[model samples]
Target: MSPSSRTPSGATEASDTPSEADETPALATIGEFGLIERVTRDRVQPPATLLGPGDDAAVVAQPDGRAVACVDVLVEGVHFRLDWSAPEDVGRKAVAANLADVAAMGAVPTGLLVGLAAPRDTPVETLEGLATGMWTEAEVVGVGLVGGDVASSPTLVVSVTALGSLEGRAPVTRDGARPGDVVAVCGRIGWAAAGLAVLTRGFRAPGVLVDAHRVPTPPYAAGPAAAHAGATAMIDVSDGLLADLGHVAADSGVRIELRRDAFAVPDRLAEVAPALGVDPIDWMLTGGEDHALAATFPAGTTLPAGFVEVGAVVEGEGVVVDGEPYAGAPGWEHFT
Candidate 1:
């Protein structure tokens, strides 16, 4: 079930109810450290963390003596809508998207730092709930919330920076995909896109797609697994499949030929496509935000479970879907 649906009965309605008079503003600029404690208290820390939220900086145990870091930013109206997604869902997505970048580097996430900007009138309870969501999702990836900053702003803007350890494995980059490599993917694809379509069409789905849009359940462990299994190149599918693959192709100077029939698109998506006046292939090829991992492995390599072979690398440039260059929308951009 989606987190919003799972919220206790009347909790949302109660939150939505207007008060006779706005409560007195708690305290302006509660100070960063004090606010951090308020948010991170009662949260669990990861086993690999040598130190957690406190001090000037967090200390994490990096067995490989190297750390992978990535950052993501979410804007209120552009990336998410407060009316549609709860604050908690926004928090979870902010952390998950950054963590996926770490995973794409073939590393296990170790810690995260969140930066939140909300209106002065934003409810303290809502901020706390958002923190809870961040902690919850970090726990799933075996990471800890190490620190953060909060400030007043006109609109909600969440930025997350994630740190990861390679566990002695070499970091995977986009330029390593050689010709004759097999391309594979781990985790669901296009669900978030389909959900976006449903939301745009003013329709409701079976909760799976909405949940996907809220919190992408990526195969976090599969990234390091692929590296150990000798993956040559890797990336996260935050941008549509073809657009992201194009990065690998451009970097490696090779062509990617995706076998569309190999994708495991959910039946719910197919069922809703006609009703929503959307095409399933559009979701499968050009949808983004699913945070799935896509990697290229040497031919004859045995792929780990939860990953499926979806394409292959060839001697050329750009990506082809089923032996032809797919001419669809490119992908997502911050400002277009």
Candidate 2:
């Protein structure tokens, strides 16, 4: 007997032959529970997951007994463009961006709760690809796909809430920077911004920059390392470097001055700047989304590997680039 003939109605049969259109589409509307199963069905759950999907809430084992949480949302047109990024890339980027926040607080990501809103016409394959990407990226931070919700909407939107454990370490917040502290960064800067520039203007560049935008590989372990090394304050560079540093400066009641020449421009960027008729320096200084960790440490403290001293904290307010006030775009704003 043929596989289809033996399979029960509404059940998808594993066979070499393509199924007929008459086959009922998997659960219409991808109802909340159905959508959840579709996304988490094949994902690998971490051992830290005390209780996974299918309840009012998921429980994660926090070895330190305290959990740190951060949430971020990605709207269809606001955060990404389907034309420029694939569904898998969108899912990974959405999850990675939020995980970077938890890492910035010097925490080990434990699990994620995702809420997806999409039109009924959205393809099940697209949703599956997104779920695959989310798990792939979450694995990088040692987290598990615990739970989520789904609903109908006009456009695709993903909201993820990431939970992390501090491992008995105190969270490194933004208000601890002080005068006489050193400012440092771990991971690339401007790569994502430059990629955006190319995507928007049709400028040609190396694939690395484009990949940077699709999936940011943040220095996940550096946050906890910096915290252990006595970092005074820390934040992930989601906004422009100067703009993000300004937050540290304002909150910590200090001034930050970045030495632009301290960091070299990647060869790929220099190669494409002229083609785009833009300065690489502008991209480096004003660009964002590299998800690099920036922190303030004691003046004489030695920065850890993967971290470079880019600036200094002084007794004042505002952030300065190379001893001068930064005069450029102020980074991403929701309303602007």
Candidate 3:
């Protein structure tokens, strides 16, 4: 199930105790701390991090008194592939996806906790590349990889827990949208889906669409901006626009009507669609992973910078494009 298709639930946590072993031939020779030391080198610390790496646990400053947190897991061959993405790209993309969730809540990201489980034979250099990728993306927004853990497993799995502060603003969840609200979006969409399609087909053309698949650039600032502008509800376009918007509609109990004329397919996507034999607009509506922010504002309210109005919230449920229900493949689903 996708995050958008789930109901609220809670669970208890079990304490984790590390297993001890002697004389292991795996992990490319150096011990766990050695690997940690290698990756932790030269990493910049975020302002929100009170106590960074090497502590028993990290202490982050949440000035708002409320912390907005979300965790994401990326498994090799499931969420990412070594053949498809460079090690660094994988790390950067992992952080970007989770960071988008923070932004979706209309909060400013503060710190990140990365957890990596890889095959025992994994190279430390490969892991360092991944760390470099993580720090590169985190530094882009003036944050750091404050804390994380490295473990041995049969496959590579990257998990990230992002922390953000709302700065006293109310969180804009999918449930807050209401009738007569204006729908808007900030940042690029469909580029990642189009890029992935091109890559899967073995097209090596260098373009913005292609790069997007490797490293998604989420509109990090738009989250806080929307909150300051009084956005009613918001979500990140990790899944397709329609699918994510469906969450807002279902939760808010309002219909969202999207205007086709309000948006246009990017030239880069249109340029690649012919060779791939698929409509670029399909990617726009259904393709996700661009990490763009989708929000609903009250009618006649001035929108935040970078947000463009795309639709309106109405009395009903579900989403529509061009005055009718969208009959396309919904969005990214975890299981078939």
Candidate 4:
């Protein structure tokens, strides 16, 4: 930063931006422009993204006439760890979390913009790996990287902004569920949490659980599919399912009652949970970061594939399991 931009107390004197003194230093090795070039290099822009990187700003066509935009940020040590999560996993997880929001809105994620803030010491190859991961994951969902910013920070901070189109469908929000709506979930829950538990305990768990913690595969098509199937409300389970569902209940002024027996715990978790001496139900109900989709469809509506009934919207408030209050905290918190 310029001297004028520095704080009066000299607190900002330790700049995270690379210094010119070391020509071979971290980011200075590639420089800002070079880093941008490396990340955007070989990226194929989709038709919706009329213009991509290498411009003042990207221009994405909103064919549906309304753009669905959402952003999420992951902080190193807080959201992820370089020691445990590879650079690629960090990039992919960031993309998945943001895209899940677009899906939650009942929209098709047409493109993504990644805003990365990292310490200058961060290796250039690491950032490139991150870029490659972003592109790979975006391609999985048929979108491309549009544009974003790279900046300096004390630690790695990944921020992804996903742009989507609703195709004339109404944006699904938390407040639309009615008393009789059937609650269904697509994707999964608890795996990430279980993976986290394993990580925290420093014990080896199943590879799938470890992978779940590293990179979540949100059901990208489920959001639009549910919307097309006439879902009344929807949300992405970045937080725990119970926590996120509580938002739906509060917004819709209806109680969401989940039947524990109905939750489809992934088969792998059966043995894994037993070994860990932890109830899989705990993770199923309160595990966050899975990026699953929980939605409410009209009662008796033929549920689409991948969506399994978990509960119902009833006349009341908050969320409950088997008609009783859940004893644990509902979900994850940001900036707590």
Candidate 5:
């Protein structure tokens, strides 16, 4: 007969208030459809998004009648850890990786589609945080999360598909680099590796490096700008500069020789690397996930904004540092 247990009609009612321990319900509590409703609600779509979530599929406009697309997948233990990063950070990193790929192709991003797999016991708030982070990164390039799907699984997995427009330009692919082309890069290179080293060593005092590992700040606009400026070949440094440049070399049948002194160690990396007993140059050479753009231009071609000369394409094969193979591991590779 207590008022707390009574409805407006004054009839007896079950308690609607949840205990403090159960305040945030698990995914099972809301069910799949409910979770979708929570994440998709109130989301704004860009003009390119013809139809967003709630439908069987999404329709995005391709202004130039050609679309560029790429996908990246992140698994819980392999790609990230909840204890090491917030859910939002993981979300941003996932979307950023795919978006970087679209940009590397010399296109402007239009929309994103995500696929999520997480345990049923996961908290609903975590998923919402993920969605929020995805939207945040998408808006950086003025795009939207057009569609996605969710499923039950033992481990959390995020797969993002980024679609883009070529805008009447041919894609700057890996095979376009020619001998005598100058090589250049357009963003931070070794910061993420330094951050990962710090995180692995049980310290986070230098937060800048740690944050880079969580959310990559790619130079999105530089992609199309490089294309307009007549870049020959381009690739995002997701798997270290040397390894990714090797892809361009092999595809174009040329050798990339880099000047060792071209990469002056940043002051922050120089200060922190000694404490971790690692060389900053190794990070610059082998670090992955920075998502910086590396491209080749004809000799004497004025480099685009934010780009600096680092090397040159030559009449040979594979990537070399100072005319020799790099001593450290090239980059990240699965199933070695």
Candidate 6:
């Protein structure tokens, strides 16, 4: 469910530990170090890792002599709800978001660091599940969880920092777009937003939609591919298509004009939107968390595989859809 639709429970910390008969143990019983051991024990680290968890800090190698880093924070009730999402799902979402940031820079992820805060009474299983999810996603890019911190808090909080290597390639930035560049996007859009809408409305029969809200499949390889194919600028669609493109526009001092016909509403979203009395196109336009990569390439440049042309960079400012400013909200904002 969306953060706006729910409230935090403000639960009290648990004091008493469960007996041996209990199948699930509370964090209070395991203690901080024990919980860490449970999550990190026997896990394999990739070759990029110089050292794994157990030290005060981790050591990772960047062959290009430059390291790319980004951090993301997800808090209970604000970013996710346990009732609506499993701990594994939450874990994967947290890691995926940060990894996508690294990917957007045309870097290959090297390692991940996590910081977790939860009530003493929280179930150890929950944290373990989260760790599993994080590891699974990290494995997709052949990276590992090198180190992290855990603490006690009244509310649950997860913070992840992902590090990457550019591998001797020029890192693509949002400020490089120019007039006459073509805009393209790779990977899915609107599915997570549609999923959030479904969950917020209190119906969860469609597993695909709800599952999408729980996890995002980012085009990690596409970032590097776009860079190698002479992409001029790029950004991940964490907030929304128009909202994120606005950043590229502001930074590059150019206008982005998108064609509505360029986007085809996924049949799944098309079928679900009418039942919910909403437009599928709206979700594609403004929904966040899809983690799709949007980029600009010079005109006449051959686009990378999986990238579909959707717009063009022009001599102007801001973004326009079908030659007009979008009437709906451009994207997500934390405070407003």
What stretches of model 3 exceed 4 Å from their correct place?
1-26, 330-336
TM-score for all models, in order of appearance: 0.88, 0.89, 0.90, 0.91, 0.92, 0.92
lDDT for each candidate structure: 0.80, 0.80, 0.83, 0.84, 0.86, 0.88
What does candidate 4 score on TM?
A: 0.91
Clashing pairs in 4: none
Q: Model 2: what TM-score? A: 0.89
In terms of lDDT, the best-performing candidate is 6
lDDT of 4 by residue, 1-336 (tens): 011223425333223344564544466555567688777777778888888887777888888799999899899999999888888998899999999999999999988888777777777878887888888889989898988877666778888999999999899998999999999999979999999888888966688898999999999999999999999999999888888888888889899999999986779887788878888989988898999999999999999889999999999888889988877643444201
Point out where model 6 deviates above 4 Å.
1-23, 329-336
Of 2 and 5, the candidate ahead on TM-score is: 5
lDDT of 5 by residue, 1-336 (tens): 001212426321122322234677766667566777888789888999998887778899999998999999999999998888898999999999988898899999999998887776788899898888999999999999988877666788999999999899999999999999999999989999999899998997599999999889999999999999999999999989988998899889899999989997889899999998888999998898999999999999999999989999999898888988877754544202
Candidate 1 lDDT by residue in tens digits, 158-267: 88999998888889999999999999999888899888777777765658898888788888889989999999999999988888988999999999999989886679
TM-score of 3: 0.90
- Show the lowest summed lDDT stretch of 10 residues, model 2: 1-10
Model 1's TM-score against the true structure: 0.88
What's the CA RMSD for each of the models?
7.6, 6.8, 6.8, 3.7, 7.7, 5.5
By lDDT: ranked, best first: 6, 5, 4, 3, 1, 2
Which clashing pairs does model 1 show? none
**Inter-residue clash pairs, candidate 2:** none
Q: Write the per-residue lDDT of candidate 2 for residues 1-336, one digit (tens) a residue.
A: 001123425643222133343334432344445556667676678899888887777888988889898899999899988778888998899898888899899887988988777765566677777888888898887788788766556678999999998899999999999888999999888889888888888743477888887778889899989998899999998886777887888889888989989878889889888888878877777788889899999988878788899989999888888888866655643101
